[model samples]
Target: MTDTTTTAPAHGVTISEAAADKVHRLLVQEGRDDLRLRVAVQPGGCSGLIYQLYFDERVLDGDAVVEFPAADGATVEVVVDRMSVPYLDDSKIDFEDSIEKQGFTIDNPNAQGSCACGDSFS
Candidate 1:
């Protein structure tokens, strides 16, 4: 498969166009124009580390931000907390809508192994 990630060396994470489009639609559905997609790594999963993805309005201290231009002419901002940076570095967030699954997926190069459910990484 072709690489859809647009990784900026200065930034910790990247978002695919499909992911950006999905996020934009969700934001619009929630009527939250001021919110951003916050990605973080939290301790505790079947593996070792778990990924956390949510909509956040507050920009915490030392948060790394990256902007992606959506097909709708609007920009989507993705934020990652300082602590999660190392775990998510060079990671790509993608969206898939196949008959089997329909959701956001993370491609993390830093992960050595992941759980059977694919929710946690070691």
Candidate 2:
């Protein structure tokens, strides 16, 4: 018999297993399979940049996509617009479910500093 090996996808950004699982659950609740987690950076925040995360049903031009496997054998897709690629490259997305914080966080190596509110980065 032949053996098969699986490798993680090489994406500009990566989502943690926890994040993927959460996304999968959200999608399941939404009852849609055409949705993708879209991440974008826009100019307008305490640090002059803000992050936008949402579920998208449409695909625009120059979009980069990466698929992650969920614990339930479902697949979660993440899409990054071309304009935000440079700022988000090599970044990691994780979900936190603790008393202190309960939300999605982005660990961006390119961010030099953030504002006092911790909502934006430079």
Candidate 3:
């Protein structure tokens, strides 16, 4: 029974409840309590930018953080670097576990267009 939600700055991206739950389970499976989910926009892919998501232990300077409380009583921290803030503003991270596709997805209102491969956006 920890705080239900801890959000980042107003302009920052958000994590959906399902995404938080999935992240919590993954973190538990990894057995590492020190890691945070890092989300970043990188320069690659068919479109102008690509999204990167991974577990990181380092809290680099200028990183924005948001915390979500999971059903398993774990607090999952999601981080985004300073450079990515603008591109990801008001975006959302979600998890899908369907038979056709299963993984984390981003819904970015800022994206003007996305690649057909679904790996990058401008």
Candidate 4:
């Protein structure tokens, strides 16, 4: 289920509390509040498209910005470029910290098929 808190943005994408917490910790570690989590789709993965997730300080034109509340009461901003909106609309981002897996994961409903590595989508 998607986050329905007041901090949730009008943007279609939703970031789980766990993911927001992780992002918050990362930002604190870098001592930079200017960074925003940027999610973009780039070409050239095995399935023809790949996900690029990183912290960006720049806000380009036509970027969709969303603010999610972190565990510490601070807000974590998630940015998605206009071009990637269609590909990531309604997508949910989550963080898993388990023995089997440990990292951020994207549950994109728009993805018709993803590569075996889960790094690309068509």
Please give the CA lDDT of all the candidate structures: 0.85, 0.84, 0.84, 0.88
Any idea what lDDT model 1 has? 0.85
TM-score-superior candidate, 2 or 4: 4
lDDT of 4 by residue, 61-82 (tens): 7887878889868989898888
- The local lDDT score (0 to 100) that residue 61 gets in candidate 1 is 70
User: Which segments of candidate 4 are over 4 A away from where they belong?
Assistant: 1-8
Off by over 4 Å in 1: 1-9
- Arrange candidates by TM-score, descending: 4, 1, 3, 2
Model 1 misses residue 79 by how many Å? 0.3
Quote the positional error of residue 98 for candidate 4 in Å: 0.2
Question: Candidate 2's residue-wise lDDT over 6-112, tens digit each?
Answer: 24433478899999999999988989888989999999898989989999987777777778888778878888888998999899999999999999999999999
Stretches of model 3 off by over 4 angstroms after superposition:
1-11
TM-score of each: 0.91, 0.90, 0.90, 0.92
TM-score of 3: 0.90
Candidate 2, run of 10 with poorest lDDT? 1-10
Error of 1 at 6 (Å): 12
RMSD of 3: 3.5
